[model samples]
Every structure is written in structure tokens, then in C-alpha cells.
Target: RRQFLITRIYAPKAWWFGFCSSVYSIAGLWAGAALAIYAAMIEHKNVAVF
Candidate 1:
């Protein structure tokens, strides 16, 4: 949300709660369909949630 500058009020209209991660290699979704969410360390990196 920070990266996209999305507000809490905008969340319901902008994003959904049910969508989860998909394998890029296997799912083959569009470029704007997925967003990364960081887990632990910065080096460990984020998970793609669609």
C-alpha cells in the first residue's frame, strides 16, 4: 500500500483480502496482477500476492 500510496479507505475499492500468492513460473499472470509483500529480512524479500 505504501509503494502504491494506497490509503485504508481506498483499500476496499482497490484491493481484496482473499487473493494470495502465485508462482510466476507456473501461474503466468499479467504484470500488474501481482504485488509483493515482505516477510522477514530485506534480503529474504517479498512474496507475490495476486
Candidate 2:
């Protein structure tokens, strides 16, 4: 059926998948790094970051 156009079937979902996969990858990395820095610099007082 024309209603099942391939582009329409995959385009938006693919874009969302790409954004979620890539952006979440970096966001999660930074969030984890920040948590580690907080634990080391503030919680454990190992060194200075600010």
C-alpha cells in the first residue's frame, strides 16, 4: 500500500533512534564523569577541580 511508504515508515523513527543513541551516549558519559569528579573531589577530597 502507498500508505506504507518506506521513507515514511523509517525516517522519523530512524532520526529519533539516532538522536537518542548518540546524544544519550555522550550525555551519559558526561554525567558519569561528573559523578566521579564529585566523588573524588568533594566526597573523598582527593584533589581540587575548581
Candidate 3:
């Protein structure tokens, strides 16, 4: 009975870990894309100002 309970608790934890990792990966991708776009915009502005 104790073993079953432990397994049940761990099962959800494993799933949660996977879910969190996927979310983190997606967020990192979005941040990288935003940074690239911002860099491009700054470059364009600098050229225009000069």
C-alpha cells in the first residue's frame, strides 16, 4: 500500500517535470526571436539616423 502511494505521487511529479521543461523551451525560443527582431530594428534605426 505504501509503495503504491509513493508511485502515484511520483507519477504526477514526472509528468509535471516534463510539462515544465516544455514550457521553458518554448519561452526560450520566444525570447530569442524577440531579441533578434529588436536587434534588427536597432540596426535599421542607426542606419537611418546616420
Models, CA RMSD each: 14.8, 5.7, 6.8
Residue 42's lDDT within candidate 3 is: 93
lDDT of each: 0.42, 0.76, 0.81
Per-candidate TM equals 0.16, 0.55, 0.66
lDDT by residue (1-50, candidate 2, tens digit) is 67547755768787678778999999999999998868875765554544
Q: Clash number for every model?
A: 0, 0, 0
lDDT of 3 at 48: 46
Highest TM-score: which candidate? 3
**How does candidate 1 fare on TM-score?**
0.16
Clashing pairs in 2: none
Candidate 1: segments with Cα more than 4 A from true spot? 1-6, 17-26, 29-50
TM-score computed on alpha carbons, candidate 3: 0.66
Better of 2 and 3 by lDDT: 3
Sequence-dependent TM-score of model 2: 0.55
